[model samples]
Target: MQLLLAHVTGIQLSVRGVWELLRTHGWSCRQPARRAIERSEAAVAGWIKETWPSAKPLPRRSGPGSSSRTRPLSR
Candidate 1:
């Protein structure tokens, strides 16, 4: 963000200065969402169709199942 600001406006600002400027203008930072740039739709579809059914079932029947909360929720 700081580098982009500097490139576009030709004004280099420090990290603190940039945050302060944004805060004064009611701007807030948000995390950028991640995406798989090199993902292949065909490969993923093939894997899901071919490998998913063969995958072992989760949590064997003999194993301890799920646990309940120690305390109940309060209204």
Candidate 2:
């Protein structure tokens, strides 16, 4: 945001200056409420238990096929 301010207004501000500006506008920082009031914890846990395995990354292969090279290995 400070970078944006400097980019748009040709003014650079220290971190404290940004905080002061936010406070002047009545913006106080607090932990975001990540969970909805109507969300069910049991439902969330059940979904994770039942569905998360499919969403996880594929198991990585090793040995000859697992080389991180983009092109064919040189002869």
Candidate 3:
């Protein structure tokens, strides 16, 4: 069980040990497909836009003397 978890996380594990475990359990795991990557990216982007619609237009800062001049901060 520990070896299987390690394999899924891409951490170092004894190949023989994991192979034996899989053979005993008759199971296997494969890497995610390209379609899954695209779906996940789209889902995240949608969630961000839905959650923060006002965040699209970021606030602008005033340039020096563009408005009323303010005193510079002292060290």
Global lDDT scores for all candidate models: 0.84, 0.88, 0.68
Task: Give the per-residue lDDT of model 2 (tens digit) for 1-75.
Answer: 899999999999999999999999988898766867999999999999999988999998664652666877553
Clashes of 1: 0
* Regions of model 1 farther than 4 Å from truth: 30-75
Residue 21, model 3: Cα distance from true site in angstroms: 1.0
Q: Scored by Cα lDDT, where does model 2 land?
A: 0.88
Query: Candidates sorted by lDDT, descending order?
Result: 2, 1, 3
Clash pairs detected, candidate 3: none
TM-score of each: 0.38, 0.43, 0.23
- Compose the digit string of candidate 3's lDDT tens values, residues 1-75: 665577788765577776776778976677645565346876788889896677678778655443435865444
Top TM-score hit: 2
Q: Which residue segments of model 3 deviate by more than 4 Å?
A: 1-13, 31-45, 48-75
The alpha-carbon lDDT assigned to residue 32 of candidate 2 equals 67
- Indicate whether candidate 1 or candidate 3 has the larger TM-score: 1
